[model samples]
Target: MRRGRIDYRMQRRAVLAEVRSGVRSVGDACDAHPDLVRAATHVGAPAREPCPLCGEDDLRLVTYVFDRKAPANRGGRAVPRESLARQHERYGDLTVYTVEVCTACHWHHLVESFQLVTRDTAVG
Candidate 1:
């Protein structure tokens, strides 16, 4: 696919459908079927969209995050209530992304902005 041709809305619908089916948790489903993740997080813009840094209209869609990612519950210790805010501060959310390389300058760029569904929000 050219990246520009993917439909994000439709892809999300499919994922949501699976969630409503009670077949598997969203996390499990996403792990098993990464395509859903890809579709939900894929970024697309005009063929000649300008790069944010270089302002060149040749930038391509790279990668993205679909939902939010939770912080790693380290060491099996119960997290202190005071640390909850820190956890959120440390890991804002789950994200998916891709890299775009400049053909002319060989400059590589990563686009990471897709938010992932938090563990709290998603099923276990």
Candidate 2:
């Protein structure tokens, strides 16, 4: 079982619905920060789907892990997926946020957020 896991698929669907229904403009939906866009190009992993808004095949996913208890330089950085286990081991308690980015259109969204807890540090 996933401990402290939270999925944001529903929220993603809602935002897509609004964009599709014309309630929210495409500009608003695709407004990703410059830093995020840069990360998408440099460190992002390939996403399964194409850009939902632009229909480009430039979608990527970037995982950012943050731990308030960690030193300022150690927290709030994008880490590779392959090293997540190592990160959890080092941080003990961390919050991870996965973001989907379309480098083509600068579109981005929060894919999911979850808490990572080491076995020793997790509360029952």
Candidate 3:
């Protein structure tokens, strides 16, 4: 299959709809790995909405930031949404991904992603 930008909002809605329709169980959907669980628990921000997977209120939003100039092995960093402006200033060309996770069931999904740099700036 061809790879391209993803419409995360649509994808999230579809998954949630499936859950709501009883087509899929939240427990089954939440199959997060140990490291992902750890990151979401420690670095993620608490979300206002409940977990779509398990209907738990312990959902968190974990953000990962990436830049072209950053080292391959050490580029992605979990950061807070409030710090995006500062990160954008520091990393001229950056892509940010916000993922929602359920601490209760290890359920995770990408909430959103976007380029954080100004349009005039050159990205490589």
* Best candidate according to lDDT: 2
**What ordering of candidates by TM-score runs from best to worst?**
2, 3, 1
Candidate 1 scores a C-alpha RMSD against the true structure in Å of 17.7
Give the TM-score of each candidate: 0.26, 0.87, 0.76
- Tell me how far the alpha carbon of residue 97 in candidate 1 is from the true structure, in angstroms, after superposition: 1.1
Backbone clash pairs for candidate 2 read none
Off by over 4 Å in 1: 1-56, 64-95, 118-124
Candidate 3 residue-wise lDDT at 86: 85
Q: Please report the TM-score between candidate 3 and the true structure.
A: 0.76
> Which residue segments of model 3 deviate by more than 4 Å?
1-7, 18-28, 71-75, 121-124
lDDT against the true structure, each candidate: 0.38, 0.85, 0.78
Better of 1 and 2 by TM-score: 2
Clashing residue pairs in candidate 3 (N, C-alpha, C atoms within 3 angstroms): 26-53
Q: For each candidate in turn, give its C-alpha RMSD to the true structure in angstroms.
A: 17.7, 2.5, 5.1
Return the lDDT, model 2, position 101: 95
